[model samples]
Target: MAKFPKNFLWGGATSANQIEGTFLEQGKGWSTADIDKFIPKEQRKSGPADNLVKRADVEFAMHDKKGIYPKRNGIDFYHHYKEDIALLAEAGFKMFRISISWPRIFPNGDDKEPNEEGLRFYDKVFDECRKKKIEPLVTLSHFEMPLNLVLKQNGWLSRKTVDDFVHYADVVFNRYKNKVRYWITFNEINVLEMSGFTSGGILADNIANRKEARYQAAHHQFVASALAVKKCHEIIPNASIGAMIARFESYPKTCNPKDALANVRANQNNLFFSDVQIRGYYPSYIKRFFKDNDIHLKINDGDKKILREGTADFLAFSYYSSMVAISPDATEGEKLTSGNLKLSFQNPYLRSNDWGWQFDPIGLRIALNELYDRYQVPLFVVENGLGAKDKLSKDNRIHDDYRIDYLKQHIEQIGEAYQDGVEIMGYLIWGCIDLVSASSCEMSKRYGIVYVDLDDYGKGTLKRKKKDSYYWYKKVVESNGLIL
Candidate 1:
């Protein structure tokens, strides 16, 4: 039996945009996720690209009338919350992480009043969690920013979006103040550069200056996140607010000095966002980086003060896989893999998933130690899982031993990290139930212990069945990870 702290939170995570299928239902407006077009597996031979320009190029692909918009029908979880929550309770979930879709509350991003129907919907969901004694960890904004915000304000590029996001945060924080104690501001906030359209709603190709636009939008998010943290502390007493990042750990491909230095630089770039959120100020090297890139952020009056005053209570991040960094002059073939919206250089020693995401369980331990050494704050692993093609057996069960092996190895690594003195507050597996993939928008790339009877083309009965990994994970949570 593996051991974890008694208070450790064990649960699953799903964002509203990925699972809640009712995109246009009950006064909900269109989100960036809603406009995402699904590409089939056969056409995805080159794999999912993480560049902002490439993502923006596909923006108009949604206009095709015959295109399958899979996000619009995300396994119909919007209507199946009761059934889903019941299954989670049966699996012994101590916590359940979810995101409140911004467009759902405001209908449009800049609305003065939130939609009553959207607010009531979450009320019932949270009430159900409370009935089952499951703590709800809520993300204020995921990738589903209102499409209206992008069309009207050019997304977070305009500072007005900051105020709009703050308004939305204030409404949800107050509404679910009692129900949700854990709040994450901006999911994977650091991915703004690579995923501007999805992360900040900035259409990369349309912008005259892409670099400046990305950084400025990121600055607005930083300010907005800080403001929300301050507001949450004020409105919801004892609430713990965290800043989330996509933790892309990097290692030098070789022992050469140049390779090691490149790895350090790569890591610094990845750690920049959390540094500002946790430390409450920009790192000194950022000024030189910004100057070298000819990117100047517009910092308004009192923004620095707000940022300094409203630091996050903890750090929450998604660690999928680590990348290898090679020097500019290094002679080696670049083996690129896809995961977490970043193209990673493949590590020779690690095994990779079917999607080309390398599996390095030790990377989780290294990331935990690195983050703890840097921030000295409590950490929550909000997202980590293997997305695979699942097949159901004739017995009406998914014998997904591969998923079980993936999770078990990661859990063992997490246990080792805990023993190494990392203060891990929780672990929430990404996409607890099958949902639409954010990068590829494909439903076939499933990542859930509980299998949903759905297909890539939106065919099937939409029935929920527990995979073999479901019972395996239930025992893990029931024993507080000891059974792992």
Candidate 2:
């Protein structure tokens, strides 16, 4: 197998909502993440909370007093950031990915002023990262939006929110411009296409057309992202700003030509997000998609110019599993599997994690090559890790060989991609330390090498301990993929 480069970035990633507790402390306002309550065991079978469906869901989440909101109480990273950074530094981390909570910076989305306490908090965190000699990769927004925006301006659905987000972007960009060199404008920005409130704080039922409103809101975000890119370049000339995507590569379930065609369509849909940001324009295929779906976007006077001028410097993405795509048939019964966003059939040959999510390390290599050959930009794997129900042994230690194996195979594939001439900037594990789950809002689905002493219902000491994978990863990083 090929070796990792000398300057390969090896680190961990955690979003503010996933790790930082004290959701309301220091004048921080409520985000969409904050309002996502935990479902009890009885209700979990029905599924996780379906928040942000309407105004009522927002009001209920905001007003519910006795609900078990686990996100509000994460691993208490707000208090343990220093210790966490030091541990990673001990493991020789070259980078650490974290998102600055927008609601923390600006209590309300449209506020004229930002919270100084929130600014001071991140200042301490970034300084700690820099002190450890670890470069910081900061995401402006990651699956979070100020709930106030939804109440006032319907989030990104309104042009006003676009300006508000840009203003928020300007404040943070200027504030941390010296500290942070690698910036992501929005985390999984394309998630807005399917999830409205989670990304954009949009309520579809309140709108006339759900699809139209979603795309229109996406247009607003595209413009906002472009404007942020332009501003970041102007403010921090040395910084590189990238656009992130939730890229789950699709596979044809069979050798049939029809299945291949269907797979092609699914893959194009996934690539559409990156194309707009990296290429600085939407592809013809997506325009055809918009026409076929009757999505007539309202292009403003200078929107096209902004998009053209604000292309991304690099492409960052999260790839966990490969999805199977097959032609729609009236007769064939499908064996479906867990997917990131879209529905798909299972790959019978691939192994699965405890969550039943199929794994394909080779698909990661293919994804890297496809992205490199198409965009020709530096790629950063910002999210790639295994989430399982990690159990603490009697000795109070975790021996997660399965996670290590999963990462080992995937890193080997990434190494192969590097040898294939793909310019990989770095690789960051999704959850370096255990925190709240974005899906179930539970600690049971643990993904961190550093385990947190916290339970699903906000119980436990909130302590941190390293697992076996921690030492293994340190060796892998120190060897620069030579040992793995």
Candidate 3:
């Protein structure tokens, strides 16, 4: 019955930009997330092809009136914080995973002073969470940068961005030191390597040699993350700061060693982010990777010391599903499949959602066991959920048994992983309430157990209602995960 810890945290997670609307209110300035426009099916060049953001798109989004920018006016969590927290608490949630918008505090990312109104807003949020006995798992940055930084500083591509981020981290760490205890330095830090503009705001098309810019920006982030960890420890004194990444663990396409080797290298490419944050140094494999790829990163003075000394206290990751890896030489006529952030050969044995995200709940157990064995630190499943379309019946109810099944199966794998001796921290389902989709920028790809009556075009009553999964999750959390 003790499959999960007595103190196991059962909760739902959402980033500020994803859930909070009123992007410019409370003294909050615009951020990178504010610029993401929803692309209709007809307009999409390909599946997530618009992932590579360009400077022109950024420029257009700033002034474009016709585009449907959902993030700018998310589910309105900005004004509904109390009500939303109440709903989550009513479902017996012990934790509420949320992120503080960096631009909200420092409008320009390098502002000499923080916007007091922005800090005051989260004060009420944390207070409500405290009143409801819901712990706040705060992420420092979640795919958001100040628009000013993107335009002027080139996001994380400039080392100066590191100092700006550290100062912002320090401000929040000191301000929320008492209100919040859990911290994640960056959400999906590895995304910078591939989706530079989205993750780091480098404006992908402007870079001539993208590989060099990506790593150089990644190096800056590595230093900033480490420095943030160090500052968190110095200021919070009792808080646990960790690193977060988009965890993509894949299998080889065939029994061939070539496929296996390709899979190993690909996994390392993703794991390299956490290695620097958790292990406090670069893996030996990365030296060959940089040299072979002709990517040179500028590592300045004392950066290594900061990394070595400021290792994360834990590892947080998002694992929605696993992919199959095949050697480039073996790509004869194999069908390719889309995944979280990578493409690979689709596995015939797996079933996919409407978004083509293959489901392998059993893969969750395998991933947890591997991560625990590798790092031996407490691991948190910060983001894992099925994004499927939900229907609202006329009775003012949403019978989303599909979502209940998705969560139940994944929770089962988590239990198996716990029995296998993984030091599990907790599980937080992504998008606990329906909000803008991070990849496609659509609200229809709902992942929440609680339904938000908003559509892709941002038309809705804006009312919140519980889905069938909500009561199901209440029982699971009430029993400390034993009921499931």
Q: Give the winner by lDDT.
A: 3
Tens-digit per-residue lDDT, 146-246, candidate 2? 88888888888899988999999999999999999999988987777777778778875657667677778888888899999999999999999999998
lDDT of each: 0.88, 0.87, 0.89
Worst 10 residues of 3 by lDDT: 45-54
- Candidate whose TM-score is highest: 3
In the order shown, the candidates' Cα RMSDs to the true structure are 1.7, 1.6, 1.2
TM-score of model 2 relative to the true fold?
Answer: 0.97
For candidate 3, the lDDT comes to 0.89
Q: Which regions of candidate 2 fall more than 4 Å away from where they truly are?
A: 45-52, 330-332
lDDT, model 1, position 8: 97
RMSD of candidate 1 to the truth, in angstroms, is 1.7
